[model samples]
Target: MVKKKIQVLFEDEHYIAATKPSDLLVHPFKARSQDRRSLLRSLKKQTDLYLFPIHRLDKPVSGVVLFAKSKEATRLMKEQWNSENVSKHYIAMVKGVTETEGVYDFPIKTDKGLQEAKTSFKTLTSNDEYSLVDIEIFTGRQHQIRKHFSRRMHNLVGDTKYGHSSINNIFRKDYKFYRIFLHSYQLRFIHPFTKEEVIISSPVTEDCIHIANDLFQFDLTNIGNEAKEN
Candidate 1:
């Protein structure tokens, strides 16, 4: 396996959090014997220790992701996650204007077949061609946010598979970007073993900022409707 860079966000005796780069799989694949790079293997090799995944971010989604260093920590983390004790937040640039805050409660099915689920969203920023959306998922389904928005009138900027042709054509169709516009910015949950509240966050990725700047000439200001417009 060839070596690659790993971005560690927060690390401790019990667990580790990382800003996962786009297009990297959390774990290795049995389907492909030739693909040698995987996040799990990279961390283990670098730390000489095992880590457990408490939750998964999609291959295209980039930013803060958590991993447990010990079995007990892993178990407890998973418990907190399953109990709806965690608050996960993501920001994305989707096509079209979202005038007010809204929720998307639609059923999402699996790609292999049909075991669909539901999710919701709230718009934080509005622009003529794009909006900065703050998203939340009630149910953990594969590509829930991506697929849901893709099926809508507007599509997330860099999404290829579920995105509409006209919207996606504004960007590249064949290439999977270095990162998608979606970013896992905030995570809040009770400490798995400590029984205390913990909140972790990552600043919105630069790629999104650049895209917004190129199109809207925006900084963080216009994300809120009340905030000054760019």
Candidate 2:
């Protein structure tokens, strides 16, 4: 088991949000895998409380993950998330330079079938090789960000699943980085229990910052600051 200190971003009676490291499962598979590392189990042990996940992040993706303290709070928070009351923001470094800003209404295929997914992106900074983009997602469809960007030829750096192998190889040899460059930087919504607006922002990992600086001379320290507004 890989032991890592769980970085809790926000904690209250009804909710807890934490920063999930890259390559860590949000929860274990039903059948379970050989690797026993999981974010939920670690949080349960660290906080010594039952926690319910309100949203999920991909195993290779890093950033904010929200949980409810109890089953009732989970139900309420899930309702708020299902509605239009929540905003999710992410930052990514893609293979190609992107437009200044754009919205993608591409539908992602799910177990149910093709579902409508919308993503809005603003190119924070870019060079000839890659673009650092700030993303706002309106839907929670499976692999929404990855699929949408990959379809448009702007595959995320280090995304072996959706990116070009040659491109990824070039980056690996050049930058010597492995994790995918997609991060859930911020989540904002109305508190289901207290009715107060809640905003949870996760800072990009040190690796992410280092790679961005090397690639685009970018600074991710305040990447989510402008997107904090509701």
Instruction: Output the lDDT of residue 218, model 2.
Output: 82
Residue 196 of model 2, lDDT score: 77
lDDT of each: 0.70, 0.86
Q: What is the lDDT of residue 181 in candidate 2?
A: 84
After TM-score superposition, the amount by which residue 164's alpha carbon in candidate 2 deviates from its true location, in angstroms, is 1.2
lDDT of 1 by residue, 1-230 (tens): 76456766667678777767776777765576566766777777787888888777777787678889888898878766745787677888888886466666766678566545555677766767888778866666678778778777657777777665666665554332444688887676777667666666666666666666666666743332221101
TM-score of each: 0.81, 0.93
Instruction: State the displacement of the C-alpha of residue 87, model 2, in Å, after optimal TM-score superposition.
Output: 0.4
Which residue pairs come into collision in candidate 1?
A: 108-116, 108-117
Scanning candidate 1 in windows of ten residues, the lowest lDDT window is 221-230
> Which lDDT tens digits does candidate 2 get at residues 76-183?
878767467888999998988899999999678877799999999999999988999999998888788999999999998888889888877887788777778889
- Global fold similarity of model 1 (TM-score): 0.81
